[model samples]
Target chain A: MPRPQPEPVQVVKQRRDAALKAMVEGVPYVQWLGISFDRRGDELTAILSYDEKLIGNPLLPAIHGGVTAAFLEVTAIVELGWSMIWDEVEAKKLEPEDLTAGALRLPKTIDFTVDYLRSGLPRDAYARARVNRLGRRYASVHVEAWQDNRSRLFAQATGHFLMPQRDG
Target chain B: MEDRKATLARQFIEAIPHARALGMDLTELGEGLAEIVMPYADHLVGDPSTGVIHGGAVSTLMDTCCGAAVMSHPSIPAATATIDLRIDYMRAATPGQSLRARAECYHRTRSVAFVRAVAHDDDAERPVATATGAFTIETNGGAT
Candidate 1:
């Protein structure tokens, strides 16, 4: 059964690394998604890790397209939710206890699209994506990868994420 | 055979640019249909719990087979890109020799083509997954 909803949770507007780690640990399956990030200003440069299990074609030693797509999708979700996490922390400034519950909230993924430009080989790989447009109703993000001086786009995925809605 | 696609179907390995590296070959082809196979490896297996092969590999192979089958038409100029691809896993791929995939163009309009495919190791009746995809043919040649 789906969990019951609490009242609409507004953006707290704060930031912390502990919150990020906590969220990452929240979803055990997320480890399989292969995503890591470093923030530079507002943009994020993420290394999309690849494991042997992700391989489809042993002959080419190329990572599978579905894994690439799934990786891109998770990257977008975490990066977008970062802002909401920060917001929640900021709200806690009024009362430290409020921030404690902030880490529990997660972003709602509405929709996303991935465009595959080049294959991500078995060699070292990563992705760089930035939020293109973030509005109340929707958001869009663009991401790609580079290795051995060759710039092959793994994907250009834009998605719609909704904030937590209010409940009685 | 009397099938148009069968006559036109490219030999799985000998026909493509890099089929040898991927261990893929033509399984069968007929009017509005064709199949390709990629030999399995230890790397394809995922967590023992799900025992499922990664979804990404399936999409890539299926996409390649579908596009290749569609481009076989001489006028098509052998160029295609995926507009959208969706895969649904019905069963897990057991560690085996190879994975076989078959695709067909269900409906072809002027600019867009609709294709579907299934992947299985041996038992064709028991498919690992089903895939439906949209392809946009680049008539200007595959270079771009």
Candidate 2:
């Protein structure tokens, strides 16, 4: 048997970028929130751009608690879905264009728990999700969001999702 | 005390920029209880194909309701901020329908308040989602 050839660096980067873009575009809420992703290989950092409409407490001028939760939830869902589709995209079994709006089914949230550590200031917030457990039918993801320093998290969440069934 | 809390609840929602953007209205408020409604909007849709509102939007509604509940609680009449919130999405909210969240502060200590809330559209029998949360009760001064 011949050894399998490794994909070129440029090819790998293009595929990853395409996959991430398609997945993000599929969610309308992500667009409404003006959320963007900074991808470095399989790692993803979700960014929520600062907006006046995101403020919950005018006195403190703090970001809404719900907005923070939404950011963490979106991060977890996207990161989880990307992990599942990475191999298919890399193997050329799935096309990036095919993952466009509603083409790829993202997991449904069963439950989510969020903890607020500090008040979210009026600024851009960043988050990253770690897949704690991924199974065929269920997945658990933990996400942490920070505004200024990554070590100091403003909010964090753990979400359990019901994975979409794969087409036979 | 009851009247004061109700006034506080209304002011609390008014001060929130996102709540105003979502068109959330406070329908009811009492001691340790609050009810808020958010009208359906295209911008809040999670799946364009289904037109279903995003779970994140529902979570926002519930979180705000819980905060209001905490603020109205007799034990913690001062301001409050969310410490932790757990939400269970029972089903997708019906498209083209507004969502209402009712929350109650079931328990409270000197510095913390516990809240439980449910969100629904036209069908209040089956909630679209439910939430339980803990909030910090500010003792020094209200968040005003």
Candidate 3:
């Protein structure tokens, strides 16, 4: 049998975009929080747009800590899910079109620890997650959230997730 | 004094936009302890397949409860912000069931307060999640 041809760069790009979209759309809380993701290849940056409903302290005019935690958790889970999907697609084990809302299973959170560096200002916030470890049964992700400057993070978190079982 | 703290805690939750949006109700409050309830809503669902509430929603509940606990503490009846929080998910919250988070500010220093909390649904015996947190203590009415 002839060897399979490598996918073109453009084809790879489209597939990546589809995968990221499906994964993000799978959760309703993301929509509830009005969170969006900007994708560049395998990298994702989660954005929590500013809204009056997001304010936790009206006096300080600060974003809610719970909202910050939700944003960071969504970033980590989506980033981890995207990495898994990308790997699966490359290995020809999955297809992007097959992914849909609630179709792809995301890893479950075992524990999450968040450190608040500063009070989040009343504005848009951005977050990105780095996968520290990925195993067959578990994964660890660290996420950082910033408002204006990338270096000046207002919050950061580390989370451990239980991976979903794959069918043979 | 207890009545004052309770009133402050209720006012605290009311001033929060997100907490109000989520329909959090201050059920019980005392010195260093707070209990808040969040009604189940369609938008809070995380898994559409199972209709389970999102873990992030639970996290928010716990965080807010912990903050209230810190603020109501006798040693620190001023505004506070979460410094750090760690949460563990014990199980998924049942859909259509309201969740309640109870928090206690078990310890405090000049500048820091320690809190622990648990979230539960209708089945109070089994907690849906538990959290431990630290908060910045502003004893002089800094940010209230």
Give DockQ for candidates 1 onward, in order: 0.13, 0.80, 0.85
Model 2 chain B worst lDDT window (10 residues): B71-80
| Winner of 2 and 3 under DockQ | 3
Specify the CAPRI tier of model 1: incorrect
Query: How far in Å is the alpha carbon of A42 misplaced in model 1?
Result: 5.0
DockQ-sorted candidate list, best first? 3, 2, 1
What TM-score should be assigned to candidate 2? 0.93
Q: Ten-residue segment with the worst summed lDDT in candidate 3 chain B?
A: B135-144
Model 1 lDDT per residue over B1-144, tens place: 546444455443444433443556776754557678887754443332333444444555676677666665434534555666656556656765478888887877666778887888777678886777777756663343
Please, what are the lDDT tens digits per residue for candidate 1 over residues A21-124? Answer: 55554443345445566655344566766666555445566665556655665566667666655555444442343224223444454444456566567765
Q: Which consecutive 10 residues in model 1 chain A have the weakest lDDT in total?
A: A94-103
Q: All candidates' lDDT scores? A: 0.58, 0.89, 0.89
Clashing pairs in 2: none
Q: What is the C-alpha lDDT profile of model 2 across B61-118, one tens digit per residue?
A: 9999998888767664657899999999999999999999999999988788889999
lDDT of 1 at B114: 81
User: What TM-score against the true fold does each predicted structure earn?
Assistant: 0.52, 0.93, 0.93
